[model samples]
Target chain A: MLKHTPFHDFHVQQGAKLVDFAGWEMPLLYRSILDEHEQTRKSGSIFDVSHMGRLHFSGKDAVTFLNKVLTRNISEQKAGQSRYSLVCNESGGVMDDVIISRDVKNWILVCNASNREKLVKHFTKVRHDLDLDFDMSDQTEGTAMVALQGPKVIERVAGVLPVDIKALKRYQFESGSYMGMLKFTIFRSGYTGEDGVEVIIPAKIAGMAIKLIAGKTDKPDATIKPAGLGARDTLRLEAGMPLYGHELTQTIDPLSAGLGWAVDLNKDFIGVEPLRKIQADGPKRRLVGLELEGQRIARQGTPVLLNGQPIGEVTSGTMSPTLQKSIAMAYVDAAHATEGTTLAADLKGTQVPAKVVKLPFYKRAQ
Target chain B: MLRKKAMPDAPKDYRYLESHEWHKREADGTITLGITQIAADELTDITYVALPKVGDTVTANQRWGDIESVKATSDLYTGVSGTIAAVNNELTKNPGLVNSDPYNAGWMIKIKPSNAGEFDKLLSMDDYRKKTGH
Candidate 1:
């Protein structure tokens, strides 16, 4: 069964293209993909991200429990702060990358919607074997999440939010009221490479929250717009953030996916032994960003070639709306994954020239 | 040519394919083919178009080439079998014409119809809009 978010009716009313994503009916685009991407880069845009999984762990040993199951050291995280961490299966493969937030009363986990059930099962199995005292509660159905991202993010959100969003540092969150009616938990973090905030509120008030951020009426406003999965994918690609299935997979290790900073081998956790061995030996294939030289767009599954020999396949690619150039991510032999390395992408029948450039084709102005 | 949100309408005298290809029997009895305005609207910001070369034989309902928009890549299916007479080479340098002028500057190819009767099977404007569920 395809589940619908709280903002499904609103997206349909705005003429969004809805698609089945991980059994959830999600909006792919509210307007043109390029227009939405540029809007989010220049000004600010809102996204309905309620489909992500939300879990709460409460008790004295909540931090200790998370530290054992997750790759990052969660015990060091201060209250009101969020840290990006990964959950790995026993085989040392990434099960999911999540945001671990430490609150005064409990620890919260925000994981990918597709991997939510699997993570829950993994957590249950881990708790069964370990001495842990914490209550794991699935709060996804009752929660609604929205992201406000871009250069003018704070300025745009300040109109509807009573809190001073500018005071919130990166990865820090605050509880406040939205338009002084509903309580909202907003954090200064986003998938897009921009200064932004993500708001988590009750599902019952999701429609009202969207209206407050997107404006009540259907008037074309440049300051704030409703972006969709299409823009979200492109923005994250430009930001060099690895998507779960694309960059980091069951067989792909985090060290090779350019996420070594997120994994701490010094800490004892699930899948740490295999990760340590892989880290010591070094990964054979590494992820890198590619910039196609010509106008031809390299799509997913397009083969990457070096000197006419097939080396790897493209994971995600698009004509970057910000740069007006084609960009892609691929896992190539570690030797070929270097800046300024010449490469080619076999697009359809034609071989388009490409170059391995630095990750993150776009960055926000500080 | 400058781009607008809505592309120009197909030549009213031309026949349209359910898949959005425009088929026009030119004054010289040769047929010209290109995508329709609705197709251009759906595939906005076309970055590349791999057009069929001259003398390449195209079969009805078969893909002759491909067009890549920023959003997706779609196959260009020929509605009528024909021997290609010419292609818009300028489109290689400027593919945005696919959205700016889908019927004029975006015209893909000219061909001598292999089966002239195939044109009658093509869809009308109303039929195309119905097929696309517009």
Candidate 2:
């Protein structure tokens, strides 16, 4: 049986097409993928991200333990700051990409749902092996998360939320209590390439919190509409974000996934040595963005060819609703990973023309 | 039990395959084929329809072309074996017609069926509705 998030009933009432994602029965789309995608790009969309794993860390040893495990150096991260980082095995291959936040009293790590169990086991094993003393709790089941993303999101939420969301810079977070009862954390970060905030609330009060923030679902002119995993996937793909199972896996290292900025090579961590070696020798393959000539999508495992010879494979792809172009992210050999390089995606038996471009296919106006 | 969502009815004269392809027998004895509304709804935001050219041979229950959406790809099939007499060229430019008008302007192909008896072998409107849980 698949697990259900706190907003499951809300999704049903909205006529969502529910599907199993990472063992959680989640909404894939409420109305149509295109409509939701457009809504997110134009206004704002509330995404039920409660299925993601939310792990809390406390105790004096928490900082030391996280610095040793995470690729990003978090010792200098001040309270109310969040950083996107990756957890890697000893060999520097990514186990999962996560967003680690430094709260006033504790630290929060939001990880991929598919890797939640595996990461819990990995972190536990590491802590036991090292004999470190820290309080780690899986708050995923007790808490719910939602991301309200778009250009208009901050303004729409300004009146409902207590904190000065406009003052919270990107990657900053603040904890607040609503109605003198409901405690929550709002982080100005999101997966979509838009300005927005991700809020975490108590699981039992999620339905009420969403209604308060998003306004009535029946409102025809509501600022934020409910989007599902379908639009989320497409929106992230257009933004050139690397998904865990698609772009980052146990065998794919951070250097090759174009996540070098997130890794602190100078600091001590579980995967630092191998990452330093990879940096010194240079990565064999690098992730690059591809814009295809036609609307045909280059799905995962599609062969990326350079003059009829396979050089790499597509990891994630979609017909970008915003751009109206077929775009994909692929891992190509370092030699052919230039921005203007031309490649072909072998879709079944046909070769479709593709061109390597910059990482993000779309960027919002500043 | 969860409430079953209502689905649009398949045309009374049409026959359907379990995969959701609908077939209509035209006055010329040729069979016109397209995906049912359920299939179109399932594969939302149809981006491209890879249609076979005229004169192409399509075997019953075999994959002829591919229908791609923003999220997934599905193989288009027919219940009747036939030679492709006409193809929906308009879909090449606007594949979303499949979702907007699955029964009318979105008709995929017109085929000269090698065996007209195959159409009668497909599921009727009521059976198709039952099979789809509508």
User: Top model by DockQ, which number?
Assistant: 2
In the range A301-345, model 1's lDDT, one tens digit per residue, is 899999899998899998887888899999999889989999899
TM-score of 2: 0.97
Q: Per-residue CA lDDT of candidate 2, range A305-340, in tens?
A: 998999999999999888899999999999999999
DockQ for the candidates, in order: 0.34, 0.49
Docking class of 2: medium
Shift in Å, residue A137, candidate 1:
1.4
Model 2 over residues B37-89: C-alpha lDDT tens digits? 88898888899999999999999999999999988899988999989999999
Task: List model 1 lDDT by residue over B18-99, tens digit each.
Answer: 8889988888878888898788767766888888779989999998988888778998988889899999998988887877
- For candidate 1, give the docking quality class from DockQ: acceptable
Q: Could you give me the TM-score of model 1 versus the true structure?
A: 0.91
Off by over 4 Å in 1: A178-181, B1-18, B36-45, B54-56, B85-106, B124-134
